[model samples]
Target chain A: MKNKLLFSLITFTTLFIMSCKQDLNDLSNETNNASNVKLVGLGIMEISYDMKTIRDYETDFSILSELDLSSVNPSEEKQHVEMVLLESGQLNLTITELNFDKKINIPHEILPDDSPKIMKTEIIGNTANFYDINGKLLGSENIPIPNHRETVDKIKEIGNKFSAEDINKTIATMQGYQFIDNLEEFIRNAPANGVQVLEQGENYVSLRMSFNKIDPRIQGASVLLIDKSINKMVGTRIYDAQDNLVQSVFFGYNKGDVQSLSAIRIEQQTHLPSGSEVKMISISQIENLKFNLNIK
Target chain B: MKNTIFKLVSFFVLFLFAQNILAQRNVAWVHGLDGDAGSWQHYNAIFDAERNINSLRTSYNTDNGITHASNQVKNSMDTFYGSNANNPLNLGIGHSMGGLMIRDVDRLTPSTNKRFGGYVTVTSPNYGAPIANSLMDGSVQNAAANACNKLNDGPLSEIFSLPYGITANLTTNVLCNKFISNDLVQDMIGTPITNYDLRVGSPTIEALKNHTNNSNIPRISIWAQESSPVHWRMFSSSEFNNDQTLVNYVNDAREIYNVFFMLNTSLAMACGVGGFWFPPCWAASALYTYRATQWYKGRSWIDDSENIWNSLIKTTRSEQQTYWAYIWIPCSYPPSLVEEKNPNPNCGQWEWREFTRWVSVNYPSDGLLPKYTQELQNIPTGNRYYVPGANHLEVRNMSNSTLNGQPNDVTKARFNEIFNRPQGDWFRTN
Candidate 1:
């Protein structure tokens, strides 16, 4: 009986080895088949990415592109928001209750000729932070937060009315959390239940409110990385209400060397509120953006 | 019997030394005129292979005279040769005017080891950079400003204006400051980039003059692409590009994107325009710091002059696990390169084809080319072609696409596949 079992095992091993060899051969053959053609394109191939840091709502955030967002963190829900600072005389974005829905003519210029265009978002929690034209804190709010809801519900409401697409993943949500702990307390710590800031350039401000306790589910910071030039968001990072920093990441760029091109800074925390996560918003959307550099 | 033994040992040692020469490629970097040895930082990062380095760095004061430049070169040679008491040296590289300096070294030093393994020029003007014509004035900033102004159709008000407008306003009968700083610029010029080309390269081209006909010395140009100046407002032109293609790369938008200073943090600090943290200069500093951190901060062993020299500094040689090792920069024409207002029509735009023409013209003249040609000549010539469609910057720096997705015309994995592939000058040569 032992001999028979040994014989069977040997046969199985031989088959396995043969299969592995065949797989490698196939892979090599495929590589060879494509070797004759140009393996590269006119430019460097773009890789996707995710949010590197928690973004503040008021400030315009542009950490990663769509390809970069997808390369770093692949998720459907995480995405970036495109925004622009409308030039109403000067820079201005007022959060009103649809006072003039009939072509209000809000003019914004994100790129040189306004390519990506500004997107308007009015999802404020009760007493949430608000920003002015320059992205500074207007005043903490304790009043009614308008249009704040879960992403899914928000998608459904806008979908039936105005072809709203689900913003699952983007540069904004490069740092996203599917689940976390200690959630309820985070909202309560804001100086006025929320803060607001001015426009997006030459005057934008960011604010941080804390909570005594938070659900680990609430990862990263409450700040949203906004695309002020484009007037959109790339991601939303949620931090623990109590702990100052579990870990934070920011967008990276190179200083004209051939060594490293892009890098994210990950700062570790020594304290509690462990396992914080971040979600990029509209990171997937950055791809749709075409710049109006006004160059030939 | 004792004599035989001694001879045998000597032969063995010689054999080992010869093996060392063939076993690994030796790459030495020479600096540009009036450049710091520190500028080799990027090269050090790109070619991490084990080899002795001879840093021929001089300061802004290096422009003092030919004697100073020559002394600096001699001192550099002494320092490099002194450092490596053992092992044979091969390969040589230079950036900008440093290219001319290396040629001088090749002419002066005929040591067997100095035969060199290869040669590379980054954004060097084999003939002469157009700006050098009027750059007789000794200041780099002034030359740069004059160049920008000429490109802008008039003397530019600031070095940091948009290229098109700057040039347009200058050309159509307005804002011409051509003569404003022309006199100050008169005494400010130094070695013309192509002066050696005229003095040396012309003779070599005339005679097809590469000594030894050693094809082992190959020339590689790494070109840094267009986006560099967006963040680095007043930095010079050659520097903005990859010193003219010795190690190709582009500016990383993630860090250098002016939006951070113009819109994002710019707005955040509008009211605090002059304070240290929020001051405009501080914001610029922040952008600069961000740029430094993006490429050189923790990535390489060398310091890529990102900060003003602080006498007190810390050095760490610990390894950093870089996810994306190499990225080829995409080729793009910078608007500034082809301004209609450019005064020197002869100054060629930074084009790959133009660069190739310059290389071909200087092929016989470059001293460092023989080393590379000799190293590769015996390999039967299947190589010697540029990676197709590869961005110039990607080969020198790790790809941004994979470096957490800054932006790209290519992917990180692909860049890595090309990047991490092994390359060396180890082919057997007769």
Candidate 2:
């Protein structure tokens, strides 16, 4: 009877240890699943880059005219920024340095001598803390968190839900563009979303896409020129519904990494009340870009 | 017979020269909002001094729309010059909203029969006054009054509570009450129809913007910056000094309290040295202690009063700075300087700090209309003249002492300069 009792007790102890191990395994699985879900939510984990933006203005009015903003020399600004997306759906942005080429007279009282050299945002707490280069907290402000994740998700959901044919058709109807092909076949065989191929070359393809469908307020369409070898969009021309060219954008790619963007140039025109037009051109150059970085 | 023929020919030539030189240049001086014909009384006198120039001060209901005022100006010009109303020598010189009215008049006048050879705008809200926007919304005045009240009866009252009645009287009677009773602040409280026309982004101003002025017609704009210290007191009377008497009293009381505290300490030291054994010495020590305690409390009151007084001055200065004109631009980061409700977050926010006024761009103003808006669009930069150290009303007819060796009356000088120029047919002989 004593041998039998000892064997039963040993069996019970073994069962209890196995049940605890199963619970541990289940908890581990849950953690992994949660991490995977977060990864899916944030497609790009982190990005750190230094950006230089140059803005130029051109106007039909006389350069000396106060209304002609072009009289002021083009403004160039450089900044280093690092952004990180956490599993909790919070985005953190750290700006190390920002400098302007033009002489800007900022008040010492407003932007004091002890002003932060490095600024960082804690989105979870909705606070932006300013720090010196030595990482000493100079000041803090309670600000509204920018809904970066939600905005990105909404954009992605819209992109995934709509096919190229449906978007193009909707855009065409709104912008008064006509499609020559039958609607059913066009919907079925369209390769790119919201884009219609205008011409195809050996090394390049020209395509037209409507911006009006995406933003109903913007009554314009964009014509894109893609470089086939690099598989990158190189140039774009934006035209109003009246076929007037309103803006143009050009892109340059990194030589080492064909997929990475190096520089972008955008020129935009705005019509003024005095039957004159003001054109603003901006060029942005990117450097030292690190993708999916662990920024803490 | 030959001498008589030569004399006849010379007389005919001389007569034609006189006609060209002495031709009557008719000028219609128009007034601004809530103004009358008398607005141009001093200006007209100066214009009258010029030879062969006819000055007519035009009066109209400025409370009416700009179009109605423009019609009145046109009718006045017609009556003043009669058959020669459409003469190219006719000129319009307008002040404030009068400038906009003249522009409307030009718009209404047919190009073939140009009523004005040229026009001049003096301290005009050509684009529109930001103050008009504030006045219409009743924000600036209300804000000033609210700030004054808060300083008098809010947290400041509690801070000055130790001094009690005197500090209370100083805040309510001298500082805030005087500020609230300021003429400019009182004037800003009334909302009139003209305020709509004078406001920035108003439909009337938009329409004027859409209708560009005829570039062929010569025009000049005169703007000024307020130099007088009195003008800077937008929310307070000129008599409002820094209340030095109260400051002096507080300083004196603090000194007295220090002396008393030292004396009490000495007495306590004496009592500790066996003076406590005598009843008389003990009673004297207790009385001194009570007196020292009272003086110490008084010292605290003095310190609090000083803080409250400094705060009051700071708050008043801040209020004055808000009403002062400044050129603003978009700014990024350093959020303290930015105005409320940032329109463009991508570029930055609107900067409205007082220091920005001096550092960014000093767009000299007439204590009312900025030089930017005073300048009519498409008007040549050469024609715009800035009168430094002159206020809004001063730009009208008041003399600016800083115009070295030139005529002190900036309005008259600018007018003479425009009319006396040889390019236009309205050229004056003297």
Clashing pairs in 2: A164-A193, B224-B365
Top lDDT hit: 2
Off by over 4 Å in 2: A1-296, B1-22, B150-191, B213-215, B228-363, B400-408, B423-430
Per-residue lDDT tens digits of candidate 1, residues B1-430?
A: 9999999999999999877655454444555543555656654653353232333333323354323453455455556555442234344565544544444445445555454444554434443332332233222243233223223321121112222322233322222222222221222233332333323234432222243244344444432222211112112122333222211111111111111112222121211111111111222222222222222211110111111100001001111121211111211111111223534443222111110000000111111111122122232333232221122223233332221223432322232232243554332211
lDDT of each: 0.26, 0.46
> Tens digits of per-residue lDDT for model 2 on B308-386?
2212211111111112211122221111112236545532212222321111112244545555688777866777876
lDDT of 2 by residue, A198-225 (tens): 7665555555655433333335565655
**Lowest lDDT block of 10, candidate 1 chain A:** A108-117
TM-score of chain B taken alone, candidate 2? 0.59
How does model 2 do on interface RMSD, in angstroms?
32.3
lDDT tens digits by residue: candidate 1, A130-234: 333344443332211111112112123223432112112212232212111111121122233332221123212223322111112222233323222222121
Stretches off by above 4 angstroms in model 1 are A1-296, B1-26, B42-75, B82-89, B108-117, B134-216, B227-430
Whole-model lDDT, model 1: 0.26
